[model samples]
Target: MIPTNRQITPETPLDSLTLDELDQLLSEKLVTLQVDLLKTYEQQLREHEETLDHLHRHRRAISLPPRPTIGQDDWHSYVYDTRPSREIASVTDLVTINFTNVHTVVDIFPVALDNIHAIYKLDSGNGYILQDDTMHLLTVRNQWTKSPTGCSCPGQASDTRCACCALGSVLCQVSASGVSNTCVEDSQINSHTCSSQSPRSLELDNAIAFEYHTYSEGVQQVVVIAKGENIHFYRLDKWGLQDFHSLKGHNTINLDSPVTHLGYGEMFVEQFGTVTRKRYLFTFGLDSSSKRYYEIVTNPQDFSIETGLSMMWDTTGTSMKVWQNGGRVIIGVQDGTNLNIHELTSDRWGRQQISLQQVLSLPAGVTSWRSYATGFENFLIATTLPLPALYLTVATIDRFLQTQRNIPRNKLQLVGVTAMFIASKYEEMYCPEIGDFAYITDKAYSKAEIRKMEVTMLNELGFNVSYPLPFHFLRRNSKAGSVDASQHTLAKYLMELCLPEYSMCHYKSSIIAASALCLSLKLLDGNNWSDTLTYYSRYTEEQLLPVMCKMASVVVKSSSAKQQAVRQKYKASKLMKISEIPQLKSKLINTLAEKSASYA
Candidate 1:
């Protein structure tokens, strides 16, 4: 343990210092010493509170129960009454979902009579869930599929069969009435026909990709680009396929283009009015050179990209950042670790690029990010773990367990707990407490149980998160031999940053938080933040810039001042009442000894 000089005692020269001076002194110490920033700073308090010792006792009380298995079925049956009994389950407001976190929300929608699937919302109503082909429409009160086979009548029924066209495809569009959308499928396909194949089999040989949007005015539109590069924009209504407009830009998105990932910018209110954010469709895929681009689509007269920033690349992926003073077309990327920036500008044609730039570099690759809203003032959130690092950590854990045959299962639990604890401090803005996990475990754990599990997990895995971007940055800068240098440093910092709240499941938040911190350090001190960014993909200055500025001025300064005063008062006013601070500690030790002897 590092030695810290004690400024407050039973008696000292306290009368001379003003409140502000005392606060300033305390703030400096806390920043330098790194105390638990969020929690109350209590030096002398009650001890041996077994209830407090356990972290998760309260969790099970609040959270929903877990499920045994989540059946693989299209979600259509749940909301679709036309489907057979086997496809649906009774509705209940409380659902114990399988393989889903407690904080996540799942929505069921109708797609087709026979098939349906659910998707997690990434941004709006967002979370991550498996992909499906059917589109859920509450307006139509129906689920529709892209394949005609999905709509086959109950049992290959003849009357419901479409006789004109044998093509096994389906297309849906809204009518001019603007009330409901209609599904159009080949007339030859029967509702009851069943094939030996699974539903998700995509015919990549010929397929088109599209996007959907819902406006605040309740106007919904789906844009489909077809085989001949024809663009079809449909506004969903009661009749079908109304106000058809064909465009030429469909061909511009070539299959041969190097990029693969596709993203759409969300609509947000700007200083002028509601602005249509551009859609970002690009990729880290290697069939083409690593490239990135943004397609800005708004009323051409209203908004556009104005200028270019800067760009840089590392190992995991590439990233770009852009900003306009009161504009809402904010875009960020992290294929892995490469970073870029772009500005929204309205050119002469009212087309936006408007110009893009690459601004900073991070040590790790970035995967995803979330920016806090105006009031709360917190860090930019991002997740930055690559497959390889996870594998490495898993391997390390396996070997440790294999070698330490004498270690009990309880000890192994501690290792897992510690690894999660460390990861949380590295990633999330609001780290879950040890009590949170204990509560989730339904009071089936003890301090010994948690600590042992944490140690075992660490000994086995080394570090929970490991990735490549740091190596790329190091290699480019000639600091160390490879990315391993960054990994080694990350491993150390991750361990040092461990907090009481980390858990196995909430690792994503930790990954994001660490990435943000890494990026901040990169800008502030020019350290190996890119490596952190690579492992945690969500770190970007555009998202983090405001929060970092606030921390220096408000949070850090105020917290230090308050905590220092609390400690000083407690030491002088309270500490004198007792001979020593460790009196309760001894009592707890004695109690543990007696309990152990009784058990033996």
Candidate 2:
């Protein structure tokens, strides 16, 4: 045992003490210090063990639920419906409706197969749901009532809520009642003076864009609007544009420059081996020296601005899109018609990092490619106008060239023309006369020979000319998402630009549309998508990212002589001079190439 109190000193006089005595004193003191340190270490170990055990018990008591299995099925089911069934053969002659009196159309909602086919049009401050035989005019009103019964109000009853009136005389009567029953009687009196407020009227003149998305409940639809610097979401029912929430606070976006584009989409990330989902709103606009991008989390349950990832690009952005499971972002900027593709990946520490992958020039004149193909295909499918005929026509020609090794390269164009002619005769309401086809070909083949080739083509195709085309899917998606007309046009142009590239033929129509729309939105500085868009397009941002980047690369290389037809046509003002946009600098292209190589 060590002494509790001891002094290891020359207290008895050092010179008088022997060597053995001094050594004994030093040994005793050293042993005492070692024992003290060991006791302290043991006490610390016990405390730490207790702390660890407490933490374990607490964690066990409040254990988290099992994480959900996230797979392709989950992704598909969570995504919007890309294809909705509709009759193709029941239609009569198409008719166009024009709203002559309306100044600007804010929104249009078509309710299909109602007792009577109807369309709802919201213009200025008024809302009109017009049917074949009836028209309902919607108005906004706010009023206070004295009874629980219904009042003479045009708005829906569910939209109104009860409120207490603070007018005189009620307070004295309530106090006269006993305090015990005062609470109950006060509630009764308060219920009687209920006031209902209606949704405020929308200012159509100020509305820049409007889109509809299904609420979390899934049944109710909410209309989101981008007006000035603010975004507003409204609940839509029989009454139009009911105020839900303004989407402000910490996530509020106040731009120094005017907002040019707005987009919304959901992002999924893996956190601690579990999938976490977040819905984000993306905005792009010009700042003092360059363009800036902002991303805000808009899941009403937890809203925040992702300022850490938001950044300003070196140039002014006209459009931007996110895809590839949020691994890639593509932006179309105005600095010499440049398209910048960025790869978002995790760094060594698993933190998100974005690097510029590719910068490419926007090729001119994709419109001509589309126009020629469209005209030829439309003539073939004139009768049924089935979109599949167009795909089949392309497929037949592709298969022929692939299998027939002996076929001459010079005959490819002729084979394509023949396929289109054969497809039209089978699908069109009235196949263009063979003479008309010959005329279109500048009388390249004699009438009899052209007729003979059509027969040969049908025999080779086994008389089946039905396949899906991307145009219909692209158009449907653009309409459903309310893509701006200009952006839609640009998307269509991008789709046409892909036609001459043999590699693009492997992709389906939906995939093509998804990529084209992604690129188009970037070019026009528009929102890439909303949750509703994801559902409708049946595509997630991440899934479309790689395709978008590929398309951007193709657009860059397509500006040469091989694609002159497309590039020349878009140079016209009528096509919005899409093809003549500025090209990206060579230095930027090289830098992007190096980055892309590194990313790969």
Residue range with the least summed lDDT across 10 consecutive positions in model 1: 75-84
Candidate 1: global Cα-lDDT?
A: 0.32
Q: Estimate the overall C-alpha local distance difference test score of candidate 2.
A: 0.46
Compose the digit string of candidate 1's lDDT tens values, residues 290-331: 334334342222111221222222223333322222222344
* TM-score, cand. 1 vs. native: 0.29
Q: What is the Å distance of residue 76 in model 1 from its true position?
A: 39
lDDT tens digits, residues 1-600, model 2?
324454445456766556776687767677676656645754665565456556745975795654333211111111001111111112224455665544433334322222323223343434455544445553322211122122222233452222222222122122222111111123434533322232244532112222223344433433334444554444445434344323333423455555544443443444333334443444554443224444343333322123335555454343443332221233222232333445443332324444675543333200000000111011001121133445556767776666566766766557766776776666555454554444334334545667676777667757666655777788788888888776776776777777767867777778888878876775566365568778998998777766666566666776664545556546645567776654322343234334433323
| Best-fitting candidate, scored by TM-score | 2
Q: Which regions of candidate 2 fall more than 4 Å away from where they truly are?
A: 1-395, 403-405, 426-430, 439-444, 582-600
**What lDDT does candidate 1 reach at residue 424?**
49
For candidate 2, the per-residue lDDT at 249 reads: 33
